[model samples]
Each structure stands twice: as C-alpha cells, then as structure tokens.
Target chain A: MMRVLVVLAVVFATLPGVIVVLASLTAGQSLAFPPQGLSLRWYEVIFADPDFRDALLTSLTLATITSLLAVSLSALAAISIVRYRSRATALIEAMLLSPLAVPHIVIGIGILQLYGYFGLRADLLTLTLGHLIITIPFALRMLITSLAGMDRQIEHAAASLGATPRAILFQVILPQMKMGLLGAAISVFILSFDDVALTVFLVQPGYTTVPIMLFGMAENQVLPSIHAASVILLLASWLGVILIDRLIGFDRFLFRDGPSG
Target chain B: MQVAPAIRSSRLSRRATSLLLLAPTTLLYLTVYLGGLVMVLVMSIDVPPGVDSGGATLAHYRDVFGSAPIGAIVLRTLRDSLATVAGCLLLGVPVARYITASASRWKGIVLMAVLSPLMVSAIGRIFGWIALFGPGSVIADGLTALFGGKPTGLLYTEAAIIIGLTNLLLPFMVLSVASSRAHFEEDMSKAALSLGATPLSVLLQVELPLIFPGILSGALIVFSLSTTNFVTAALLGGSGRDLVGYEIYLDILVYFQQGRGAALAMLLLVVVVALMALAIQTGVQRHEVRDTAARTRGT
Candidate 1:
C-alpha cells in the first residue's frame, strides 16, 4: 500500500509536466493532446516573436536585479540576527518574515495604491521592488540557518590572533558561508523569476515577464505557444535546480532544521 | 563577565556594520513594501472623491459584505482554500513518510520530484491544466468516450482550480513534512510494535502526535497560498466560482473600482494574517509541550 501510494504520487506529480511537453510537440496550431504530428513549429514561433523575446529578456533582467538585491540584504540581516543577542532581534526577525505571511494579492494592491500616491506607475522598477520584498525572507531564512549551523571556532581563533573584526568577517566568516550564500542566491533568483501574483499588478503595458506574458496568452486563448513556453520554463527550472544542487548540496540547504528556540 | 562586555561592544560594532549592510533591504521593505500595505489600508476606507464627495467612509466595507455576489465569492475562496489544504496534507504526509523511510539514495530523487513543481510558475502550470482539461482535450475526450458522458470541459470549474492550486502548493507541504520526519526517532515505532500495537496503530498513536506541528504549518501555508491565489482561480473558475482574489483583480482592472478593490484586498489580508497567527501560536504551544516532555524525561 505504501509503495503504491508513493508511485501514485510520483505519477500524478509528473503527469501534468509530461502532458505539457507532449502538447508542445503537437503540430496543430491549437493545443490537442495525442498530437496530429510532432514538430518544433511552436518553438520556432516563440523564438521568432520579438514580444516573447523581449518578455524573456525583461524577466531575466528583473530577476537578476531582484536576486542581487535580496541576497545582499538577506546576508546582512541573517548575520545580525544570528550573531546578536538583543531585545530587538525577535521583533526584527518577525518583521522580516511578515512578508511571507501576507498574501501577495494584498501586497500587490498595497503597492499599487502606494505608488499611486507618489504618482508612480507600474513598471520594471516597481515590479522589481515587489519581488525583492517577497524574496528577501527566503534568502534571509536560508542564510540564517547556515550561519547558525556554522562553526564559531574559526572566527574565535581569528579573533584570538588579533584579527580585525572586518578582516575576520571578510576573510573567515564570509568564506565559510559560501555554500549557504550560493543556495540562497539560487533560491532567490528562482522566486523572483517565477513570481506572477505581485508582478500581475505591477507590470505595465509593453513590459511583461515571461510568466506574465504566458498568463496574458493563456487568458486570451490557450494555444500551442503557451505549451512551448511551459516546456522551456520547466526545462530551465530543472536545470537551475540541478545546477544549484551541484554547486552546493541541495539537501543540506533545504532540510537544514531551523534553530531549536 | 568582564570579558563579556568587551566582547559585547565588539559584537555591537559588528552588528552596526551589518545594519549598514542591510540598509538597502530595510529601505525597500519600509518604503516600498510596508509603505504600500499601509497605503492599501488607508484606501480601503477612503470614499472615492466623485462618488461620495466625502473624504472617507466604511461604505466600501459595507458594500463588500452586503452584496450577495461578493459575499459568496469570499465564502467560496475560504471553502476552496480549506479543501486544497486538506487535500495537500492528506496526500503530502504519506508521500513524505514513504520517502523518509526509504533508503538514502531514493530520498534525493524523491525530494527532487516533490519540489520540482515549485520551479514551474503557477501561470505555466495552470496553462498545463488548461490543455489537459480544456474543451476537446485528451483527458476530457477520454472521459466522454470511456463513460459515454456529456462533453463538459473541466476548465473554469472550482474543482479544476482546486486541483491546480494543490499542485502548485504541494511542494511546500512535502518539504515541511519531510523535514520533521527526518528527526523522528526510529525506536518509537519499534517500541509501539513491541508493546503489541499494529503498524497503523503505532503510526497513529506515536508518529502522528510528533509530526502534527509540521503538518499544521504545511496546511496553513497551503491554505494561505490557495486563498490568496488570483491567476489559477481567475483562469479556471470562470464566472460560476469567483474567488476573492479574482474579484479584487476584476474590481481594480476591469471595473475601475479602486476603493472596492482595496477593501477586498484588505479583508483577504486580515483573514489570512489571522489564520497564520493562529497556526503559529498552536505550533509554539506544541513546541513548549515537547520541551517540557523532553526535560522531564532528562530528569
């Protein structure tokens, strides 16, 4: 019974993705499973469309900026929260994690209204800021776990040798945190890249991320083009997971238990 | 504690430097994120300039609650979220337990399989459902042919929306459950069996209590994600099963009712935060109980 359940779960999980791949291969202009004939026509079409290309570029640019910003901020926040013993630490930690608890729709609406007050409209910058907000908590949490689990003896030894605080952080602590930082960076990039809810409100006309573009296309009509996009994204994300796992052990990063307290 | 003060002053300086490093993120959260949330709260109560000619009123809130259509949408959103959360927990916990009990090599592959869904965007995954369950698709056609049933597309149905949200949120459930499962001691199950308990009884009487906190957290995350989801509910729910998230989107974008939209958004936010707080408080209580038990055992 247990084996059957596990197998069922795996099959169910993979079914949608397999169908998406098969649908993308259909030669029919409209989506139909059990393809009339397999072909790369839709893939060619996606590549040829300047809008699709531009959306992909925009998504890449936005995700890159969001990830960089989230990583740096989270690294600092994680260091402080882990190293400090202060009254404000718990409040600050809760405040940072509050974004995760709140719904993205609310955040999107909030951002729209706030931007309206400043006469700022939805654009790449607003979208980036929104994604950054959502992504920071994940980055911070991961890095904090890494810091908490790290050996403090190296830093103490450096201090005993009369190493400056800056030198200890830069030369000793930073090097040890590399795996954690790399994992956090990859996860943040993925979050920013895959975001749709927050981006839905903040995206402007003529500027759409890949997911937003796919959403627009799906809403207007479900077509083979959307399947092609799904296949590409799935493949890209799979590649990203594998790459990150290779760079830093994925299991350690993911399954690292949080602080006991 | 003499050296502790020197150590504390040095740590304080280090923390200050770290704060400087975190300045940009703090600015983004305060100015862009939290600031935006505050703006939405203010707008929720604000009466549109032309409509009321009055500055602010609770009229929008009254409208949201008083209207049958809007009220039904909120209820449907809550119902669907609860259903999805239940489904994910029922499905995810068993799968996670199976993976945790399996050999180390299988664990990695199983974990990846579970988490791969998180990589795909919700939009793309919903589109995948669109192709599978949309009119004239293989799944729909197969159902009709096999059962000699009417050709009804499952697209734009509440069931389809729930299924999509479950798929999107399942990874979170599995990840949390599996983490907790890893920490379970092997002897508890053996001890139960030695005491003449059946396998099922051992699982229920011993393991379930230990892992309930992780399960609760997973359920809360999944529920919150499903309730707040806009794209799947909008794309799959059609007109019959409008959720609060979809209504907010439609109000702002389609109807141009900014005040109503903000009000709906605020309501959803309040409910979701309250739910989360409740879940966290329960989790903390469980933690305290576990700590007390462990300490008593130690003595």
Candidate 2:
C-alpha cells in the first residue's frame, strides 16, 4: 500500500513537469498533449523573438549579478558573524534571513512602496535590490554553515604561523569554502532566475524578466513558445543542480539544510 | 599583566574589523528590507490623500474585513490551503517513508528524480497543468472514456489549484519528513514487532506519534506556502477566484489601491506568522519532551 501511494504521489508531483517538456516539443502551432508531430519549432520561435530574447538576457544578467552580489555580501557577513560572535550576531542574522518568513508578494509590495517613497525608479538596480533581499538569506545560510563547520584549529595554526589576515582569508579560508561559495552562487542564481512574484512588481512597463514574461503569457495566452522558454529554464536550473551535485553532493546540500530557495 | 594592553587593543581591532565586514550588507538590509516592511505596515493603516497629510487609520483593515467578496476569498484560500495540506500529508508521508526506509542503491537517484520538479519554474509547471486540465485534454479524455459521460475538465477550478499547489510543495513535505525520519530509531519498531504488534499497528501507534512533529512542520510549511502562493492560484484559480495574494496583486497593480492591498498583505502575513510561531512553539516543546522520554528509556 505504501509503495502504491509513493508511486501515485511521485506521478502526481512530476507529471506537470514532464507534460510541460512534452508540450514544448509539439510540432503543431498550439500546446497539446500527444503532439501532432515532434519538433523544436517552438524553441526556435521563442529564441527568435526579440522580446523573449531580451527577457532571457535580462533574467540571465540579473541572476548573475544578483547571485554574485548576494554571495559576496553573505561571504563577508558570514565571516563576521561566525568569527566575531557578538551579541547582535543572532539578531543581525535573523534580520538578513527574515525574507524567507515573509511572502514574496508582500516583499514585492513592500519594495514597490519603498521605491515610491524614496523616489527610486524601477530599473535593473532596484530590481537587483529586491532580488538581493530574497537571495541573500539563502547565500548567507549556506556560507554560515560552511564557516561554522570549518576547523578553527586550521585558522589558529595559520595565524600562529605568521600568516597575515589577508593571507589567511585568501589562502586558508576561501580555498576551504570553495564548494560552499559555488553552491550558494548556483542556488541563488536559480532563485533569481525563477523568481516571478517579486520580480513582477519590480519590473516597469516593457521591462520583463523571463519568469515574469512567462507569467504574463500564462495569464493571457500560453503559447507553445512559453513552454519552450520554460523548458530552457528547466534545463538551466537542472544544469545548476548537476553542478551542485558534482561539487557538494545534492542530497547533503538539499536535505541537510532544507529547501534551497 | 604585561599582555593585557595588547589583548585589549587586539579585541578592539577585531571588533572594528568585524563591523567593517558586516557594515555594507547590514546597511543595505536595514534600508531596503527592514525599511520596506515598515513602510508596508505604515501604508496599510495610512489614510488616503497622502502619507504625510493624514493620521493613521484602520479604514483599510475595516474595508478588507467588512467586504463580503474579500471574506469569501479569504475563506476559499483557507479551505484550499487546508485541502492542499491534507493532500500533501497523504502523499508525502509514504514517499518520505519510502525514501528513509529504502536501502536500495538507487535511493539518491530516485530522490533526485522525485525532487527535480522543484527546480522548474512555477510558471513552467503550471503551464503543464493548463494543458492537462484543459478541455479535450488527456485527463478529461481518460475520465470520459472511463465514466462514459461528457468530457470533464478541472481547469480554473478550486481542485486544480489544490492539485497544483500540492505538486508544487510536496518536495518540502518530503524533505521535512525524511529529515526527521533520518533520526528515527529502528530498534523501537523491531521491539514492537517482537511483542506481537502488527505492522500496521506499529506504524499507527508508534511511528506516527514519533514523526508527528515532522508532519506538523510539513503541514505548516505547505499551508503557509499555498496561502501566500500567487503564481499557482493566479494561474489555476483564474479570474474571480483570486487567493489573498492574487487579490492583493489586483488591488495594488490593477486597481491601484495600495492601502487595501497593504492591509490584505499585512493580514495574510500576520496570520501565517502567528500560526508558524504557535506551531513551532509546540513543535519545539514536543521535541524536548520526546528527547527526555528517549533519555529516560535509555536509562
């Protein structure tokens, strides 16, 4: 009975993704199951469209920048919080991680209101700011874990060996945290790339991210090209997952710390 | 005593260095995230015509609470979220048990395959549902042939939203349960079996009680996620069936009523956080009790 339930649940959980991939391969004009013929015409179509291309470019650029910024910021914060052990460390960490507790939609609204209040325009900078709030927590948590798990003896030994702080950071600390930094970067990229709820509010007219564009398509008219775009995103995200598996082991990263994004 | 001054200076320098390291990100969060949330709270109660011109008012809250349509939407959100939680529990427990209990070589691969859907964007996954639940779709056709009636579709219905949400969040449930199951004692089950307890009885009487905290936490996550989910509900529930999040979207984006939107958002946030705090409180207390019981048993 348990076996049957697991099978059913797996199917229920995975059927949508499988269907989406299949539907993206439809040779016919519209999306349908059991495609009239199988082809990559939809992928070609979406790729050829300038708007989709622009959105894709924007999402990639945004994800790259956001992830880099978030990881770098978090790497610094992790160092301080783990090494300093100040009374305010817990509160500061919680403040950084509070985005996970708030809904993305609320974050969007809050940021939108903040922009309006501050007279900030809804541009890539502001959008990156919003993504930072969402992505920072994930990066921070991963880095903190890696930092906490590291052997303090090694750092002490480096210090006693007449190593400078910069030398310790560059030669000792970063080399050990290469996997954590890489994993955090990949995870944050995926989160930023897939983010829609917050990105929707941040985008001004004619400036849509890939997920937001797909969201608009889903609401108005879901072309097979939308499915194609989705397939592209899925593949990109899977590529990230594979990289993490190679680097840090997927199960250890995922189950050990809960959901990535 | 000779090194005391040097140690104090090093401590001061360490404090300064740590502060320097943490300053930029801390400042950014303070300005944007903390500042933005405070703005939302202020906007929710601020009277119209201007933020600076008016005293704080509860008109938006009153509007949200007193409106019948908004009430109905809230009720629907709660009902669907609860149903999604129930569905996840039913499917998630068995899958989690399978993951934890199986010693197969393919365990990691199977787990990855089961969870890979979480990597896909929500819009992508929902588009697949749009295909499956549409008229003349595979599900509709299968049901028609099986039941011998007109084709039935679940598109744009409450059931569709429930299914979509359950699928979207099942990974979290599985992760939670499997993590908890990692620490489960195999000896207790073996001991129960040796005492002539049926497998089903052992599962129900011993295992479920032990893992109840996992289930509770999973339910809380699923419930909170589904309730605040804008994408699935927006896509599956369609127009006029907006969840609270979607309703807030319409109010702020479409209708341009920031006050009402802020009010609704705050209400949703407060309720979800309150439930989480309450559940986590009980969950932690229960975990402590369980640990104490296990210690006593060990002694």
RMSD of each: 2.9, 2.6
Clashing pairs in 2: none
Clashing pairs in 1: B156-B236
**Per-residue lDDT over B1-299 for candidate 1, one digit per residue giving the tens place of the 0 to 100 score:** 79999999977786677576656777777888889888988888887776847667898888888899987887898889888988787778877887677665666676677666776555656667777887778877887888876766677788898888888888888876776566566666887799899999988888898778778878887887788888888877876687888889888877988888888898889889987887777567556656764675569
| Maximum-TM-score candidate | 2
- Candidate 2 C-alpha error for residue B163, in Å: 0.7
DockQ of every candidate structure = 0.56, 0.57
Ten-residue region with minimum lDDT total, candidate 2 chain A: A252-261
- Chain A TM-score per candidate? 0.94, 0.94
Worst 10 residues of 1 chain A by lDDT: A252-261
lDDT of 2: 0.85
Candidate 2 per-residue lDDT, tens place, A1-261, comes to: 988888888678778878989988999866656556899999899989999988888899999999999999999999999999888777788788877778888888888889988888867799899999999999999899999999989999999999999899989998998989999999999999999889888897678788888888876775788889888888888798888888888877776543221
Q: Which candidate comes out best when scored by DockQ?
A: 2
Per-residue alpha-carbon lDDT of candidate 2 for residues B1-299, written as tens digits (9 for 90 to 100): 97999999999999898889889999999998878888889999888985555588999999998999999999999999999999988998988888787777656766776776666566778888987886667877787788877675777889999999998998878876776666577778898999999999999998887777878888898899889998888888889888988999989999989899999999888988876776566568556756865795789
